[model samples]
Target chain A: MGSSIAANQLVWHHDLTGQVLDPASLNLFWFELTEGAYGQIHRVKAIVEIVDGSAWQLSFNQGEDPMETELPVERWLSGRPDRPSQIEVVAGVDFDPIGVTAACRVAGSPMRYYSIIKPSCGSSHENRGYFLYSWQL
Target chain B: MKIAVISCIHGNYEALNAVLSDIDDHKVEQIYCLGDLVGYGPHPNAVVEMVRSLNIPTVQGCWDEDIIEGLNACECSYPSILAEQRGKLAHTWTDQEIHPETREFLAQLPMTLRVDNLAFVHGSPNNQHEYLLPEIDAFTAMERVLGTGADVLFCGHTHVPYVRDLSDGLVKVQVKRSGVSETATQIHVAPLKRIINAGSVGEPRHGRPNATYVIYDPESAEVKLREVEYDYPKTCAAIIDKGLPAIFAWRLARGLEYAERAEDPTHICER
Candidate 1:
C-alpha cells in the first residue's frame, strides 16, 4: 500500500512485445523480479550477466535493422572460440525494471501496474536460488 | 449458505469418503467437486462412481482432461526426468484402467462453473493445466478472475490450498506496436475478487497426510479451509496393492507431492 518495498520483496515493471525479449538473449533471470513474500516495490537494482557467446549483447529491437549494443571485450575477442565470454553485471543487465526508458509513473499515476508483486513466494517451491549478476537494492 | 468445494481427489476413495462425510457434518447446502476424480490413486472407478452417484457439481481438472484428451501437461509439469517417467507411468495406468463411463463423465464436466457471483474452475480460467498459485503474478491473477466476470473464483490443482485477494487496483499497460500509434490500456479492479484453492483430498502436498477442502459461505463471503484426517494408510496400502508406483504411497503417507509439479510459481501454463 505504501511506496516502499517491504523486506523480502521483489518487483518488476516491463512493457515490451510478445513481451520484447530476444530468444538469443539467453536466460532473462526472472527470479530477480519475483522472489519474496511481500511483493512490494521501493526500488530495483540488478546486473545482467553474459553466460555464453563471444558477442555478448543486449538488443532492444529484433527486426531487420536491430539496435544492438555490444559489450566491449565480448565483441573485441569474439569468434576466437578459445575465449568464450561470460561477463557479469553492467557488462550485461542489472535489471532496473523501472529504468529511464519507460514512459512511466508510480505514485502519481492514476493507474499502477508498475510491478507485479508476487506476495506468496516465500516457500521452498518458489525459491529457485539467486542466479544472477546483481540483486542488491 | 455453506458450500463445500473439493478437488483433486486423485482416485483415493478413502479420502474422498472422509471429506464427503466431513462436508455432511458441516451441513453444507451445496457441494462442488473441482475434478481430477481419477489419476495417481488407488480407486479411480470407485471414486468416479461415488462422485457420479452423489451428483456433485464438478468442473474438469487437468488430470480429468488428460484422461479424456490424453496427457497434455505444460511446462514444469514434471520437474525432472524421473518425475516425468513416474507421471507417465501413472498416466498410462489411469488411461487404461479408467472406465468408459468415467472418462465420459470427465469429458462432460465443464471447464468452468458459475454460481451467482462465484465462478469455479479446476485451475485458472484459461486452462485446467494452468496453476493459479497463491503467488501467481498479480496482473495475471487479476486478469484470470476478471475473465471469469465473478466476484470470487474457486480453483485447485496445485494440491496446496490458499486464498488470494485482488482488490481496488489499477492495471495499466503501454502496448508497443509495429508502425502504429502507441496505446495504453487500463482496467480498474475495485471492491474485491478472491481466488480460493481447495487443495488436494487424496495426494496432499502441504506437508501433511490429511485431506483438505474448502467451505465457503457465500452470504458472509467467508472461507474455511478444512483438512480432514482419513485412513490415508489404507489408501497408501491400496496404491501398492493396486500396482501404482510404490513411491506414490510413501509420498502419500507424508503428504509429499509425488511426480506432480507443484513448484515454480512463475510458471504460467501455456496451455
Candidate 2:
C-alpha cells in the first residue's frame, strides 16, 4: 500500500529536462513514498481537466509485494465530445530499483512527469508503468 | 390549378387558422406542408389535427424529430433549444393538445417527398438541419440542389422565400425582397435545377410580420411567393393565454429573422 503526499509538502527539486511547464504543473509531483521490509510503494494523485474548466481528482495507490511488484496508472487528454484526445494505462505499473517513473504522454508527445521514487526493496524486481491524463479547451 | 406549400406551423393555431381562412378563397387544389407542424408556437395537437384534416402530403422536420424523439436525437442551435423547450412545456396543457395519432403521423412522415419533378423537404436535401436561406451564396445553393436529383426542390426551414436557378451554365438566386402588395408579381421558372424555400405559413421572418406561402404551378413553371396579413393581436392573445413562451409572441411582432440573424457575428444583439 502507498499514500500520496500533499501538494504543499512536495519540493520542486529539478526540471531535469529544462522544459517550460505550466504553473499548475506543481500538482504532478504530489506523491507519497513508503518503505517496508519487502519493497517500497508510491501513491500518485490523478487530476483531470474537463472542457468546461472543471477539475476532477482521483487517488491511485501503487504497492509492491511478493505476488505483485507493479502499480496501475491512467491518463487522458481533451474531454470535448466533438474532439477527444486521451492517454490511459490498462494494466501494470512503473517500477525502478532506484526511483519510480511517472510520465504523461499525450497526443504522441510527453508533457508532464512526477518525481521519481526509489524502492527500498531490492534491485532485481521489475518496475511496472501506468498513467492517464485528459485536457480540453 | 394553384398549389400552396406551407410549413413550420409550430403549433400556432390562431395564425394557422387565420392563414387557412385567407387561403380558403384561393380554391387551391392541394396544400402540401414541408414539415415542422409543431414547435415554438402553442397548439401542437390543434395544428396537427388541422393539417391532418386537410389531408395534405407532409414531410418530417428536425423540430418534429426533437418533439417526438429527444433533444439529443439531433443537433440544434440555441434558439432551437428555446423553441423545443417551449414545445415540451406546452405538453402540460390539455391532453387534446397533442394526440397520440398526431405524434405517430409526425414520426412516420418521410424526410423527403417527390411531387413530379419537384422535391420537398423541411430543410435542405443535403442535410435536414441546414437552412437554405436567401442570403446564402449561389455556389452553396447549387451544392445543395446538386445533392438532390430533382429539377425543383421546395423547402421551408429558414422561413424566407427565394429561388435559386442552377442551369444554362449560370446560377442565380432570386430573392423576394417584399411581401405581396396591391399588384401581385409573378415568378417565372425556367427548365433548370432550382432550390426554393416556401417560407413559413404561421411565422414569417422577412421584416413583414404577415404569414407567407408559395403557389407553385407545374404547367406554367411559375412560382409565386405570397404573404397575407393575419390578426396578430388574436394570435398573440392565444399564445399568451396558452402560457406559451413570450419570445414566440415577441418575435412575431418584430418579424426579426432568427436563424439568419443568429449566424451573423455582427448581429450579436439577436444572439
Candidate 3:
C-alpha cells in the first residue's frame, strides 16, 4: 500500500449501545470494543455513515454484544472534513472508569482507531489529491 | 463425494456463522471457499480468523486481492457516485481493520484452486474481475469456463446464484500424437460441462436476505443451493454503531437495492 498521512487525532465517545444512532440521519461514527473474560477484544466491528441522505452500515460479528451507533447527518457534516464533530458522544455508554476518564480530554487526544492507509499508495500513486480516510465514522 | 462451497463473505459474520452451522448438519467430505473473506462488512479480522482456523481451502476474490495488495477501487457494479464512494470507503476501512496475519493469508491465496476435476475461482478462470453473468452467450461462457479444463467449474462473483450447463456437441475430433506414426485419431466430445456459482454467504442480492451457499454432490451430479437466515437486525445495528454507511444496515433486512430505501418509509433508516 502507498504511504499517506495519518488521520488527525479527534476525541470520540465510543458508543456501546446500538440505539443511540438514528438511521434516518446519516453521520460519521465508530464503535466501542467488547472485551472477553480473557481481556481480548471481541471480533465485532461496526461503522455507520450517511452520505447524500443515504446511510451506510457496516458491522461484522457473530457472537454477543454486537454494538451499534447513529451519526446524525448534521454532526457528520459539521466536522473539519477530517474529524467527527464533538456533540452527542455516547448516549448511554456503560459506566467504565477507564473509558470515562479517557473521554475527558480538554483538547482532542490522538486518534486510537484511525490508522487507515491512504488509498493512493500503489500503481496509481501520483493522484495524491486529498487522500481521505476510509472510516467515515 | 459431497463438497460444500462458500464465497463472497463480505464480513457479515452472523450470516457466515449461520451457513457454517447449516453446513455442519450435512455430511460433506470437503469444504472449499472461493475467496473474498473480507471487505464491505465490519468483521474482516474475525472472518479471516474463522476460515483460517477451520483450514478451509480458499481462492482469492477481487476484493480480497484489493485488501491485500494495497486498497484500490473494487469491481462491484455500484451505479451512483455516492454508492461508489461508500464502497471505496468500506474497502479502506477493511484494509486498516484487518489483522496483519489475515492480510498475509489473503495475499498468498491463489487466484484459482483445483482438486481432481473440480476448479474454484472468485470470478472466471482467467480474470478475477470478470463477471460470468447467467445471461452470457454460450460460446463466450464456454471460452472462460473451458480455460480451467476441469470437468466442473465452481465460481462466485455476481452474488446471484445459478447453474449453467453447456453441452459440447457430439463430434469426432482428430488428435495426433508426436511419437506415433498413425494418423489423427477421432474421439467424441465430453458430456455437459457445468458452472456453479455458490453465491454470497454474507450478503445476498437475489431478492432474498438469506445467506447463500452450494453443495455439490458428485455422485448424483447435483448442485444444491442453500439459503439460511441469521440475526440481521443485530448486524444492521452494528453497522450503524460502527459508523459505516447507514444504508448498508438498512438494506440487510430486505436485500433490496440501495435506492429502494428512499421509496419505502418503513426502511430501517427511516425508522
Assess every candidate by TM-score.
0.65, 0.55, 0.59
**Highest-scoring model, DockQ:** 3
Candidate with the larger TM-score of 1 and 3: 1
* Tens digits of per-residue lDDT for model 1, B151-207: 899999999999898888456656767887866566564578889999999889998
lDDT of 2 by residue, B1-271 (tens): 7788888777767767777876687777888899888765667878888888888899998677766765432102322222223344543442336678878888898888887777898887755556787667766666566556678889988887877676753444454556744554543334467877888876778877787888888788788887878777676677778766444565576564322222221111111
What are the runs in model 3 whose C-alpha is more than 4 Å off?
A1-137, B72-78, B169-190, B257-271
Poorly placed runs, candidate 2 (over 4 Å):
A1-137, B73-76, B79-97, B169-191, B257-271
- Order candidates by DockQ, high to low: 3, 1, 2
> Evaluated on chain B only, what are the TM-scores of all the candidate structures, in order?
0.94, 0.79, 0.85
Best by TM-score: 1
Rank the candidate models, highest TM-score first.
1, 3, 2
Quote the positional error of residue A87 for candidate 2 in Å: 46
Docking class of 2: incorrect
The alpha-carbon deviation from the true structure for residue B173 of candidate 2, after best TM-score superposition, in angstroms, is 22
Tens digits of per-residue lDDT, candidate 3, B1-271, equal: 8989999888888888999998988888888999888877778888888999999999999789878666434212332223444566787778778888988999999999988788999988876666777877776676666678787889897787899998973444467789988778655465688889998887677877788899999878888999888887877777778766665665566664222112111111110
Candidate 3, residue B120: how far the Cα is off, in Å: 0.2
